[model samples]
Target: MEATLSVIGGRWKGVVLFHLLKGKKRFGELRRHLPNCTQRMLTLQLRELEEDGLVKRTVFPEIPPRVEYELTPFGRSVEPILVGMRDWGEKYKARL
Candidate 1:
């Protein structure tokens, strides 16, 4: 469990959570932001977040189809942590 938390603690998970803070987003939208990430990896991360009860995915019926992901209250609780990480990252970069 500790290892799993660490796995989803940073990297694309934080990025994904940051975007979700704005509201819901589709898979493609997430892809646009994290251009270097592969579809398979993104899918896996999203599934993990969902399993951890941090994200909620909704699907809609349409011609092209629609799927959206948003944060749950549990996930929203991590906003301050994300902000602190962003601040720390900027400070670390400035020092380097």
Candidate 2:
């Protein structure tokens, strides 16, 4: 529904979550994985996901600083949904 779409419907949000499903990743790592997304847009999407309580951000105290993003317990609940979407997409692609 509308609520779910509102949280993950953006062009980059779902992609971001999909990457996070693999494991926690740093800002740079995420940027590399989603090469098409600009840094600013990625940052914005991450903030939104964090605000929605679906993504957790951890900041480490270091000279250069380190930050990592991972899914919250609630967020993990969506894994099956994303996997289903992935499966459906694969099927659709095959049909084509």
Candidate 3:
């Protein structure tokens, strides 16, 4: 659990993964979705996830250039864990 938290606990990290679960997104698209996060922070988080083998980053050469991010197979493995936490949080909130 400690290790898991270390990888996912940074501010906005979990939120980044949560939104990526929906589908692949460009850097600008992710920025728009995560409006509260600064560009530098988002870039760092994505690099960490990539290093962890949980996220894939693809670059395309073009006039404007393009980059996309998506979850890897290992990253998809984390979905159930996130869902479980969500369920537990909802139940706990009800008790409050």
Candidate 4:
């Protein structure tokens, strides 16, 4: 659907969600996973995901502060779709 696509349509969004599937991660961890994505772009994509109710961002109060990202229950609903995409990609890769 158009609405659904809009939320996860960007190049980095789906990738971001994919990494979050494993569990919560810090900003640095996400950057390590998506090395090509600029810090600014990653920040923007994460903000959008948070707004869409697919991702949750938490900030801890402490020296240097800690932040983490994890998928919300609503976001977990997309697990099947991501898994399907991964399966399809593998098949397509083999064909090519």
Model 1 residue 72 CA deviation (Å) reads 0.6
- For 2-95, candidate 3 gives per-residue lDDT tens digits of 9999878888878888888899999999999999999999999999999999899999998698999999999888898777877888999999
lDDT, candidates in the order shown: 0.89, 0.94, 0.91, 0.95
lDDT of 1 by residue, 12-66 (tens): 9988988899999999999999999999989999998999888999999998999
What are the RMSDs of all candidates, in order?
A: 2.0, 0.9, 1.6, 0.7
TM-score of 3: 0.88
Residue-level lDDT tens digits of model 4 in 17-90: 99999999999999999999999999999999999999999999988999999999999999998888889999
Sorting all predicted structures by lDDT, with the top scorer first, yields: 4, 2, 3, 1
For model 3, the run of ten residues with the poorest summed lDDT: 77-86
The candidate with the higher TM-score, 1 or 2, is 2
In model 1, pairs of residues that clash are: none
Question: Which of 1 and 4 is ahead in lDDT?
Answer: 4
Worst 10 residues of 4 by lDDT: 78-87
Per-model TM-score, in order, reads 0.89, 0.95, 0.88, 0.96
Clashing pairs in 4: none
| Candidate 4 wrong stretches, greater than 4 Å | none
Instruction: Kindly indicate the candidate among 1 and 2 with the higher lDDT.
Output: 2
Off by over 4 Å in 3: 89-96
| Total residue pair clashes for candidate 4 | 0
lDDT of 4 at 75: 95
Task: Give candidate 1 regions above 4 Å deviation.
Answer: 1-4
Q: TM-score ranking from best to worst? A: 4, 2, 1, 3
